[model samples]
Structure formats: C-alpha cells, structure tokens
Target: MNKRLLSLLICLCLFISVFAGCSDEDTKKETEETTNEITSETSGKTEPVVERGTLKSFGIVPDDYVSFSAKMFDILGLDTKEDIYVYNVPQEAKVIYIEAYSFDGSGWKNVWDSGAGITAPSHMSGEIAIEIKKDYSLKISGDYFSSTTKPLTLSENIENVTVLKLDDFWEFELDKEVPVYMILADEEKNEFSYNLEDYPSTENLDGVDIAQVLTIEFSSEPL
Candidate 1:
C-alpha cells in the first residue's frame, strides 16, 4: 500500500508541474501580445508623412524668398535691408496656407509646410522661399463679393515681398520697396487687369465693378 501511494503522489506531482509550465508560457505569450498591440497603437499616432516635390514644379524660385522671423532670415543669409511689398491685395486677406523650401548644393528641396515640422540639412546652399496662399473673400462697402482670382505669379525682377501673419491678417514687410502687382479678374465681365490706372476715367459698360488695388505699407521692423 505504501509503495502504491508513493507512486500515485509522484505521478500527480509530475502532472501538476507540466500544467504549471503550460500556464506560465501562456501568460508570457499573452503579455507579449498585449505589448505588441500597445506598440502598434502608439505608432498609428505618429506624425504625418510630409510630401516631397521640386521647386520648379511648385513655381517657386530663389527670388521668392520672403521674410520669416528674424532668426530664420539670419539662417538663410537673406538681405534684411530690402523693402518687402505684397501688392494688389484685397482690403481684407487672411493667409490660409504656407509652404517652405530650402536649396542644397544640387537642387531645391521642399522642407516644410504650414502645419508640418521643417526638415532640412544643417546648412543650406543659400536658397529658400515660402509660398503663401490667402482666403479669396473680398469685402467692399459693407458688402461681400464672391470672386475667383487667378493664381499670383511673380516676375523675375520683382522681389522682396515678405508676408507675415499678424492677428488674422496678412502683413507685408518690404525690404527693397518694390511695386508688387496683384492681378485680379472679373469673371462676370471676363476681364482681368493688373493696372487699374491704365483705364480711362470715362464710364464704360464693361468697367470693373469688383476689383480694387490696395498697397500695404509697413515700418522697417525686424521680423
């Protein structure tokens, strides 16, 4: 009887050891799976991937460099003495988007956008520019007009238009004091004019009723 009881106890002990080992392995596997799930969830919340494109494709050139903060200007080796002017802007304009680019030795690289973080080399090849877009709503004489204006294209000689966002409005800080023309179009009349002064004072049927030219002036303050 004693031998039989000892044999039974030894078998029970072996069974319990096998079951405990299986439980430990299952617990460890569950913990690893939980950790992996958390890691995947965290990775899903990472920053968005920035888009890459060429400067020419986006119609950006070195002369399009506008004034950033004073620190950014210093970093890009820009001449701060030139007057910056954004011409032909509407009476009320708000910047809706901004795109930044940097030039390395070989080519111009899109470095940043308005909401994304900037990515660039430690040193650039002295070329940088920012493209700004503003809201198209025009308010005139306590009335609002819904008009579509064509995209602005800067001339090769026209430069030094630094746009900054200040209190929900776009502010132009001029460096070279150049005249920048904002070409506006009247879709209803199917006419576009850059120089309103060129037209005669005589009243005509096809006169521009919606477009007006505005020149913004700013003090020589460091951005």
Candidate 2:
C-alpha cells in the first residue's frame, strides 16, 4: 500500500508539470501578439501628410474690375451686357499660368493678367477661372461683339477650368452686384456658362454651387 501511494504522487506531479508548460507557452504567445499590435498602431500615426484646400478667388478685386468686364463688347461694336473675366488660384504643385479678361460696361478690350495674389487658410492650391461676354444685339452693328463679350464664352477649356468650393467664397462679401461667370469651352470654341450670381437673393445656398447660381437670371416679371 505504501509503494502504491508513492507511485500515485509521482503521476500527479508529472501531470501538473505538463499543464504548467502549456500555460507558459500560451502566455508567451499572447505577449508577442500584443507587442506586434502596438508597433502597427504607432506606424499608422506617422504616415505622410498632404495639404488640402477649399474654394478661393482673386482679391482684392482690381480697382478697375467692373470697367474691364464691360469693355469686351464695346470693341466689337456690340452694345450688349455680355462681359466676362477669368482668374485662377493654382496649387503650388501644379500652377503654370493665370490670366484675366473683362469688360465692366464702358467699352470692349482685353487685359493681360499675370494673375492676382490672394491667400485663404482653408483653400489649398488649385486653379479656377471666370469669363463674361456680351450677348447678341438687335442691330448688326451691335451684334458682333468681342470674343470675351459673346454670351457664354470660356477663357479656358473644360478640362482646364477651375472650380470653387462654398467655404472658399465665404471669405469675401458682395460689395456690389457682381456677375460670376464660370464658363467652359469645347473643340469648336463653343462655350457654356454657369452663374454664381451674388447679391439680392433669399434662397438656400448651403452646399449650393456658386457657379450655377451666378449664371441663372431670376425673373421678377412673375409667371
């Protein structure tokens, strides 16, 4: 009986030893997995950073801004209200050139713009432009307007056109009635215009396209 008891004790000790070894292995694996997870988290935090931008415009609007938009039609002998101007804000990484041409009302002509230098904290570097031109007049003498004064003229091609974000235009106020012409050109020089009309409106502009609003004329004539 004494020898049998001693044999049982030996068996129990061996079983405990095997279980303890397995537990140790499991603990080690858990620790390794935890360390790997921490390393991955740290790497994610240090990823590369890139800059972002919002809607933007050229300001201070040149002192002659209004006059410039109107002159586009005068040169063509067209006494019409089709005047356009274009400008852009380029991303530091992608800007090649910027230009502007306008007729504010008095006459028609072209103006070379090296471009305006304005900055907005919320705006990233990108290109956007504007155009205004005169529409068809009743008399033939007034019918043929300047290239830019033609209703719906694009200073830049569609792919080259610049777009604006709502946040970007909030930085400036509409001091006067302004016609914001966002135009696009096709292969035959055909162009389309979207209005970002500013001043005297009581509609929701939240998330609205400023370019689209400017091109549409609201009729007060009443339907």
Candidate 3:
C-alpha cells in the first residue's frame, strides 16, 4: 500500500546522511587548514628571548680592559693582575683544567686546586682553589687537576676561599706569576701594584688606569 512512499522516504534519509557526512568532512578540512596556518606563522615569525649559551651579566672591571686569570682558592682578592681571578666551578665538570696567561708578550702558567687528591706529609701547601664557574646543578670530582683547561683563578691564601656549595668543594688554585697591571681602565687613575718580569718605574701613571693582567683559561672534557 505504501511501497513508493516508503522508497521515497528511504532516499530522503540517505540524502540527509550523505549531506551530514559531507558537512563533517568540510568542517574537518577547515580545522586542519587553520591548524597548519597557525603552525606556519609561529614557525616563521617567533624568535627566542635570549641567546643560546649566554650565562649571565658580568660587571665592569675598574678599567676598560678585560682580563681572565687563575687564583689561589683560599684568597679572594680584588687586585686585578695582582690578585688571582677565580670562578666558582660547578660539580658537573669531571675533568676540568685551569690555566693562566699574560699580556704584552708575557707568558703562561697553571694554577692549583685542593682536590688534586694529594695527601702531602703535613708540610705541603694545603690551599684548595677552583677555576670553573659553578651553578646549582653541578658537582666536583677528586681528579680536578687532570683537566686541559688553561684559564683558572689561582690563590693559596686560606682566608678568601669562594664557597661553592653545589658540590661541597672548596677548590683553591694559585697564580704562577702575580699580576702587575689593571686590564680595565676607566679615567679614574686607579693605582694597583703587580709583579712584572723586570723592574720598571714604580710610579703610577697619571691619566691611564694601569693594571697588570693575569690570563686564566678554563677547559673541560666533552660532555
């Protein structure tokens, strides 16, 4: 009695299903296109906030000159080229080395560390110095002197040790040659005494801020 009507109704239902599926497909395509656009724009336009390996900001030395050097771990001296430069090394450096240098055709030197694992007969130097800059996540090892690093902060003075708390270490290194000049010069005529190879005039310059410099190099094994 209603075969034709029923067949027409079935066709209408199929049409509705197909149209709904097509609508869903169109919606999915639009969503995918929008996601791709956002991804492309973000990849092409965004930039990083900071440089890759930059650690932190350093302050100005007394003069315009910048010097790197080693130090005795026990003493912390502000005497540039006179006192040793020091870096509170982290514990992560397994095989780190510390070294020193000089300017104006000077020379090279190696500093010391207390972690050399040496148990000297009660008379050896007991100063423990360090050269590496240490963050909170690093550690120090017993074999600190086996590093190929050259720039180090060296000092044997037991009074001014930098306390690096990350690895429970108090590394102390000493400068081979005491610094004699200021690396940085600001027109203030800052006067400091340093040891030079030969004896020159002891009078301080009037205008230029002179600092005897000590170059400390630091290096470590590959991670």
Candidate 4:
C-alpha cells in the first residue's frame, strides 16, 4: 500500500510540472505579442505627414509707378523671366527669400527684404518676398514702366470694381476710367482672385496707377 501511494504521488507531480511549463510558455508568447503591437502603433503615430501637389497664387502691385522686375532663382542660381515666369527648384532648397531692389538711376538698390521685414522705401521697385514649401505663383502688374513722375494705366473701364485692403504701405489713386490690378488675399476662398469686387474694404490703398497683369510661377518639385 505504501509503494502504491508513493507511485501515485510521483505521477501527479509529473503532470503538474508539465502543465506549469505550458502555462509559462503561453504567458511569455502573449507578452511578446502585446509588446510588438505597441511598438507598431507608436511608430505609426510618430511619422510625419507631408503635403504635396498644392498650388498657391498671389497678385502684387508696386507702391509707386516705378518699373518692377522680378526673377526667380533656385539654389543653383538658375533664373527665368516672362509674363508668368515658371521655375522648378531643386530639393536642396529649403527656404526661399523674396527681395526687391530700386534703381537709383545708376544701380539696383535693395529696397525691401522679406526676411528682415524692412519697410519698403518711398520708391519701391515692386519686389516682394514669400516663404513656402510647395508650388507658388506671383502675378505682377505695372512693372514695365519705371518713371516715378508718371503713373501707368493698368486697365480702363473695369466694371464691378471691389477694393481689397493691404497691410503694406502702398498708395493708389481711384479713377473711374482706370482700374488698378491688386494682389488681394481671399482667405475664405483659399485662392487668389483678379476681381476687385470680391473685396470691398479699401482702407489701406487710396489710389493706384499700375500696368497690365503679369504672373510668375515657382515650383519646389521637378517639372
């Protein structure tokens, strides 16, 4: 009877040991699976989302009746010109600076620097700057004539006029016959518009004498 009882106890001990080992393996597997899941989720949350294929346009007029010339250059110093100049920037370009220069009858003088926020000189060359990562367009008008004494006629008999206010210290002359082409920002629409009727507030600009509309387009991605 003693030997039989001892044999039974030994068998029970063996069964318990096997069962404990299996439980330990299952627990370890579960813990490893949970750790992997957490790691994947954290990686997904930390990754940044990049914006691509976006278009932005701007309309700009100089403060005075000075001739305005605008050229876009990339890191490699390549430049182009047109009514609406288009440029493709390299990947190396991280920041773009817009600057304006005035001609003192001899040489070009730096008038406005966008990076420094310098107030434009009384005689601005109608140069402006903007910082952006995606593609952009600069619509220019009244840049052909440079005579400070004379104001160029941008448009005549423009109907449905709506004036937009600008923060920059620019002046305009209101004429019923001649219409000014202004670069007005419409935040609600999320795009640039040529029509002045879209904006009614003319508190910033009083009168303007500008030229025909010109546009310059810039792209960060390859064409």
Question: In candidate 4, residue 143 scores what lDDT?
Answer: 23
For candidate 4, the per-residue lDDT at 205 reads: 28
TM-score of each: 0.23, 0.21, 0.22, 0.22
Root-mean-square deviation (CA) per prediction: 20.6, 21.1, 17.6, 20.1
lDDT of 3 by residue, 1-223 (tens): 5999999999999999999999999999999999989997887533222123221112111111112222232245443221222233333322223223223223222232212322323212111222333221112222224232233223333122221111111132332222222132323333433334332333432332222232222223332
| Model 1 ranges with Cα > 4 A deviation | 45-223
Q: Which parts of model 2 are misplaced by more than 4 Å?
A: 45-223
Tell me the lDDT of model 3 at 88. 31
Per-residue CA lDDT of candidate 1, range 1-223, in tens? 9999999999999999999999999999999999988997987533221123112121112222332454366578776432222122221222212223222333324443222111222111112222224442211110111122233344444323323211111223332121122223332534343243332222332333332222223223322
What C-alpha lDDT, on a 0 to 100 scale, does residue 94 get in candidate 4? Answer: 27
What root-mean-square deviation over C-alphas does model 3 reach? 17.6
- Candidate 2, residue 20: lDDT: 99
**Decoy 1 TM-score against native:** 0.23
lDDT of each: 0.33, 0.33, 0.31, 0.32
lDDT of 4 by residue, 68-164 (tens): 2331233345544322221122233222233333223333344432222112232122343222111222323222212111222224343232322
Residue-wise C-alpha lDDT for candidate 2, range 1-223, written one tens digit per residue: 9999999999999999999999999999999999988897876533222123222353212212334433454456664432222222333312122222333233212333222223342232322333332331111111112122233334433333333212212212222223333322233322324223432232322222112223211111212
